[model samples]
Target: MTETLLVTGASGHLGRAVINDLLDAQKVAPANVIATTRNPENLADLAARGVIVRAADFDDPASLEKAFKGADRVLIVSTGELDLKSDRRLKQHQAAVAAAKATGVSHLLYTSMPNPEPVSPVLFAGDHYGTEQAIKASGIPYTIFRNGWYQENLFLALPHAIASGKWYSSAADGRIAHGARDDMAAAIAASLASGSKESHVYTLTGPQAYTTNEIAALVSEVTGKPLEVIQLPDEALTEGVKAAGLPEDFARIIVSFDANTRSGRIGMVTDAIETLSGRKPRTLKQFLEANKAALLG
Candidate 1:
């Protein structure tokens, strides 16, 4: 049976990758996929390829209901709003869940965080937890993918650090199983294509875990740049990032990742990616090597 797969946030990085994996790699028929975004024009190529492209805004419930219609499985990619002052992201996720329920979607998949705890320093943890609760309460058979931090996220800080020959962090010997975003998207694409009825929770992490110091060493090896990991107090770390011209919200997010790592909340290593996608997850080394040119600049 060819089932319709509705992927929200389709214009974004993860969403586009999942759709591509579904159509090109997973061999899911393009006609069976629905790619929804705020601007359908962004997905014109997908539409040209026979994939159904729909306009669905997270803030627009009626559009979500329309876009989700007739979908067998739907993936509600978590919204990117990080302003803790507002509940917009949670409301958007809630809207997606409600739309899925109303459309009678067979199974729903949600991109979540690893160990979404209320007390965690990761500022976005609560938003993911709340979304998970809403999915459970929706009485929908679902797959919850607790995606680990993206190895590509290193680009946010690595270039600047390499230039200065120092990597600043407050993680204090903490490790992270940073998986590649594309690999997680592939896993999600595979799961959606399988059309299985079982409800499962997967903690998707990298093939191996690495500490901040270890990553710094790898950077030094990869780029021949003597990068030193500077351990700073949390307050000092935040101030440093802010002084480097990062917005306070983003600076706090970076610091919180370290704080969460120090607490051992982001270091859970798992084989869930291979179990789901029938392939080993990409290593941080592979990711770094592939993007070396970009990181060097």
Candidate 2:
């Protein structure tokens, strides 16, 4: 029997991209793929394409286990819940890992960020670390992909910066290797469909790393939009983010991203994307060039 592959959070950008690549590029039969989300209605298109769509709530273990039934492999896309007090992100991840184990998944995969070790400044690094530990302790074969920051993440900061002709940062001289979200998704889909039972961890990143200044220069070149890179102290950036209407907790998290970067924790470049997907991950410049319009706006 062909392995039944299930991807959780199918309604999410990464999960949906993975499922699409699985069908269109990896050539995995739609009949053998199961897409799980909280709202099955969101994946109606995939369902229409003969993929099984099941409602799986990470907070509801029974629902997750039922949704994962008979799956030979499963990917747990990390949840967005970052409630520090409740530690809901780690709990949700643990719940998913438990459900995957209970349902007897042969192989498990997880999406994690680079340098989720304790020393990382990112407030939510703990969530990914705990999830990886849980997946390991579950006694199932697993692949942990420590995904790099998405090139698309620039959308969060760039559009505003471009409009004002100023890019402010606390990531002084820090370099980051940004992988295109879709490229990362495609690579993940390839690995999922490859049916490799080997349990291992890999870091996926773009072929090159660029500092904030370099990224800004490239953006300036592509969009003909002049930009000035303004460096600020971590505390100042945190305050700025807070002043921009983000919650205090969120501001801290945003600042910690720069902290992590400044500490040289997120600049690792690897060939894993090409090795897995059989294609080079898009360069940051290419990503910028393609999304120039989006960046300009």
Using all chains and alpha carbons, the TM-scores for the candidates as numbered come to 0.98, 0.98
lDDT of 2 by residue, 1-297 (tens): 799999999999999999999999988999999999999999999999999999999888889889999899999999878887787889888999999888889999999988898888999999999999999999999999999999888898999999999988999998999999899999899989988999989899988988899999999999999999999999999898888899999888888888888999998999999989999788989999999988988
Which residues of candidate 2, in runs, are more than 4 Å off?
none
Runs in model 1 lying further than 4 Å from the true structure:
none
Tens-digit lDDT string for candidate 1 (38-125): 9999999999999999999999999999999999999999988888788899999999999999999999999999999789889889
Q: Itemize residue pairs with steric clashes in candidate 2.
A: none
